[model samples]
Target: MRLAILAAYAAVISTATASYAQQSADPSGVWLRDDGNARVRIAPCGSNICATNLWIRDTSKGEEAGDRLVMSLEPKSPDTLAGTAYDAKRDRTYSITVQVSDRSLLTRGCILGGVLCRNVHWQLAR
Candidate 1:
């Protein structure tokens, strides 16, 4: 009975760890905006993922180089991550979803309470 319990507990822990890692697919890469203006890098930072702007053509919208969006995301699907992004520079948090593919990335961000939203597409930067 003791051995059985230990084995079952280990199995449960393994399963949980595996599920958590599912969100760790191929989100790390350098991407270019579909508009041909911005270049960003997405990579793991500490325990979460961060999307940082590498280059920006238009800084009029309060965006600049080195701006980063730290995301705490969960695996909503095999290729999607649903979570919130915290912008430390702006002191704002937004509901965000990231859909990742081999050559494309789609990001949707909405202000708190889902009042204002925007969707942007990015292509893998070679």
Candidate 2:
């Protein structure tokens, strides 16, 4: 009775987990910021996706642009991801949602308990 129920629950849980893993999207590419200030390379790290700064347009900013901007994203769908975006310039972390498109990635980062947010459309870099 109890054992059989537990086994059935475990089977269902594992099946769901496997299905989720298979549906995750790979947004791995070199993407350019909308303002053209920097470029970020997103790639798979372990079981999650991570983004790192690849290049910066200006060197006079005196900020470390070559750091990780986003890491350990949760896959919402085959075209969307949810994670935290770290702004090195402001030294803040905001909740972000990334939507991948054919030629662009739309990232929306929110702050102040989601009261303020900024959306950046990142085009794929050649």
Per-model C-alpha RMSD: 2.4, 2.7
* Predicted candidate 1 versus true structure: per-residue lDDT over 71-102, tens digit per residue: 99888777888899999998999999899899
Give candidate 1's TM-score: 0.84
TM-scores, one per candidate: 0.84, 0.77
Error of 2 at 97 (Å): 0.6
C-alpha lDDT of all candidate models, in order: 0.91, 0.81
Q: Pick the candidate with the highest TM-score.
A: 1
Q: What is the Cα root-mean-square deviation between model 2 and the actual structure?
A: 2.7
Which ranges of candidate 2 are over 4 A from the true structure?
45-49, 58-65
Instruction: In model 2, state the lDDT of residue 118.
Output: 92
Candidate 2 per-residue lDDT, tens place, 47-71, comes to: 6566777888876776445677645
**How does candidate 2 fare on TM-score?**
0.77
Determine which window of 10 residues in candidate 1 has minimal summed lDDT.
Answer: 19-28
